[model samples]
Target: MSADTQMLSEFVFIYTPLPTKEAAEEMAEALVAGRLAVCVNIYPGVTSVYEWKGAVQKEAEVVAFIKTTRKLAPDAIAAARLRHPYEVPAFLVLPIESGNEDYVAWARGQAKA
Candidate 1:
């Protein structure tokens, strides 16, 4: 199916944090280059605390908000895994049931499904 005509099942927003902006962009670029994701927005200065090895740790990370079609979720996640620094990265996908139709269309259109 043509990428445009390809029906985007729904929207999914994937998120993961990086230690640095460069690293964050690297993951984004890789996904976009491979057509796994359409866009990724990086936000700095996020504090994260989680349990690791039965201990609580805190760190500052650059959060990457990835926008992509549902069909590309697996590829997008795989791309992130390849670029993520942490052995266990915080990758979460949130389905977008409702959003601006036009904007969603543009987002889906931007991706080469």
Candidate 2:
């Protein structure tokens, strides 16, 4: 079977903003270790501008792109929340509509328990 046939709509990308690179790395390791995610790409130097508590807020943060399957999305999200420091964290689960067949299959295999 093709990668699409094997894992289409089965993968997801969880986007989360962390206070620092250390936190992002820690969460990434936890997710991979728990098998909740296959891989997590961390990007630092993110400038976030948002409104919180009825006021605008701006801060520098790191972004983590967690790769996992739909089956583990909930667990992964919950796990991430536990490690998050913010009062309200953003765990955006975005679907992988399409991707490299091999890469997709590999991620799917590694992410599955």
Candidate 3:
């Protein structure tokens, strides 16, 4: 889909990893309260392996699955970035091509509010 088409689509899932569970929870609460996302699911005990500053690194993290409509993805991303501890946080947004219609509608309604 085109970028605009994707942005106007019904669903988008934002993935971000925080340094700690508490940080993840705080960010999730702030995003939901600000209406940037409908729900933020935190999965702790995540082991992340990546390269940083020309060196391979491994670290423990809490991954946040932020559920929201495409219309609110940008705002959700911005909110996450502001609260993220990493210098360059992982703010990945994936489009949901298909899902339960009612749930999608509910998510959209939640984000819109």
Candidate 4:
């Protein structure tokens, strides 16, 4: 809330998978159109490797980089949850240190924060 604040915001990266790419595309559209996010980069064909229950696991996932303000985080999470096929989607938020003024403005404004 200052002239030098530089429009602080958060970008939430969500990892999910669907039976069809259509579902993924639909999710990306819904979030951006609803203004829950300024932009959503939906990356398909991601192979993820991780540990689960003390065992290693690997799978395909689509990563969605959702850009928005901090205030809209809840709404963004909800939207992703509603559309994601996973019982528990990977929702990780990255705080933006600084960015272009116009882009940051749009992101923060869209977030509804």
Q: Least lDDT summed over 10 consecutive residues: which range in candidate 3?
A: 2-11
Best by lDDT: 2
In model 3, the clashing pairs are: none
Clashing pairs for model 2 are none
Model 3 over residues 1-113: C-alpha lDDT tens digits?
86445544767889999899999999999999998888999999999999999999999998999988777888888888888888988888888777665776677677865
Candidate 4: where are CA atoms >4 Å away?
Answer: 1-4, 9-20, 53-55, 108-113
Candidates 3 and 4 compared by TM-score, better number: 3
Q: Mind giving the per-residue lDDT tens digits that candidate 1 earns over 1-113?
A: 54333433467889888899999999999998888888899999998898889999998889999988887888889879988998888889887666666877787678875
Q: How many collisions per candidate? A: 0, 0, 0, 0
Local distance difference test, candidate 4:
0.70
Error of 3 at 17 (Å): 1.0
Better of 1 and 3 by lDDT: 3
2 or 4, which is superior by lDDT? Answer: 2
What is the TM-score ranking, best to worst?
2, 3, 1, 4
Candidate with more favorable, higher TM-score: 2 or 3: 2
lDDT of 2 by residue, 1-113 (tens): 66565565688899999999999999999999999999999999999999999999999999999999988999999999999999999999998777876776577678756
Error of 3 at 25 (Å): 0.6
Q: Residue 69 lDDT in model 2?
A: 90
Give the CA lDDT, 0 to 100, for residue 14 in model 3. Answer: 94
Deviation from native of the Cα of residue 65 in model 1, angstroms: 0.9
